[model samples]
Target: QQQVKQSPQSLIVQKGGIPIINCAYENTAFDYFPWYQQFPGKGPALLIAIRPDVSEKKEGRFTISFNKSAKQFSLHIMDSQPGDSATYFCAASNSGYSTLTFGKGTMLLVSP
Candidate 1:
């Protein structure tokens, strides 16, 4: 059903800047929300994630904000660097399901 939708097909920012990527979902059945980062020619890797129980989560310079009621979430990359430039994807999965439905993807460029 393409439950997850992400905005900003592309983004550009300078080093040490913060890039915010937003996403919305339609399925209340989704219990897990994850954001992934992928470099060119590489597979996507989990960057950060949040569950409905938490309003937000943080790992290093990456953070995730989740709203259970609104079925929405977003990712923030703090102090972004050129190495952080990549394609980001937002995804959702049901509680009992292992498969994830992913958003189209947001390409981010961090300029040096």
Candidate 2:
């Protein structure tokens, strides 16, 4: 099975500090990169994503940095808040394929 490895099992940051989560994969066929955020009682939700054609993508306080050649990507939350505390996951898949490989989640705590 394809795998995506994530770093820093957990993280703690100040209210406004940026929390970055990294993920690396080995599959060159994987072209879609997405980040998901999950809260206590809710299922994971798509936060942001980027394609291999782009180097970076930003949406509001969330950003995704992609390195196509390295087959890696990362998610960054800028000006994090207590409400942002949750588990973040990175995933990769080929658009034409039905399989999606996800990395182990990173639990983030944003201090108030």
Candidate 3:
């Protein structure tokens, strides 16, 4: 199992609304869960991550909810804003090389 899949190719959120994206994987061997945020024409930067040992992880307006048993995970964006409109990617990897297997990507558009 070495694949992580994400859905909702794109999303739209109001300035103060919350946007949620879903992801699922088949690999139980994966230990690192990382969500990356990317602006137009830029590389994605690590937003937040959680290990399999943790059930959930949160940072600033970004939160990652994980379910080890189901091999599923999700990203929640709180207080979504125009500046937050960007491409978000979900990735997973085992404890070895930091080579991340990334999702297709989800484009989030936060409007005023």
Candidate 4:
């Protein structure tokens, strides 16, 4: 597993808006970058991810923008909604391991 770190601990955004969260990793060997969305009283599930070779990746209202050169990446939540209010975690890991190193955590509050 790689040591990944994220910031802002929490975020507040308006409904139908976008909220951006940043993360950085120290290991250059890490090849997998994944973002996870977690609701209250639940475990985090995969949201989006990008490999080191890719500059950006998106799925639905979730997007993962990666900067391999900078060993950094971020998650962008588009059209944020009250239902989207939850904790987001940016994670990284190398091959051969199922374990992920997550950041402290970010709680996103989408106000209706």
**Top-TM-score structure, candidate number:** 2
Q: Which pairs of residues have clashing backbones in candidate 2?
A: none
lDDT of 2 at 101: 88
Cα-based lDDT for every prediction = 0.94, 0.93, 0.91, 0.88
Instruction: Please give, for residues 81-110, the per-residue lDDT of candidate 3 as tens digits.
Output: 899999999999888657789999999999
Worst 10 residues of 3 by lDDT: 92-101
Deviation (Å) of 62 in candidate 3: 0.8
Clash tally, candidates in order: 0, 0, 0, 0
For TM-score, candidate 3 versus 4, the one ahead is: 3
What's the true lDDT of residue 83 in model 4? 94
The Cα RMSD of model 4 versus the native structure comes to: 1.5
Better of 1 and 2 by lDDT: 1
Which residues of candidate 1, in runs, are more than 4 Å off? none
lDDT for each residue of candidate 4 in 1-112, tens digit (9 for 90 to 100): 4577898898998999999999999988788988888988888998888888879898998888898888889998888889999999988888977777889899999999
Q: What is the lDDT of candidate 2?
A: 0.93
What's the TM-score of each model vs. the native? 0.96, 0.96, 0.94, 0.93
Candidate 2's TM-score: 0.96
Clashing pairs in 3: none
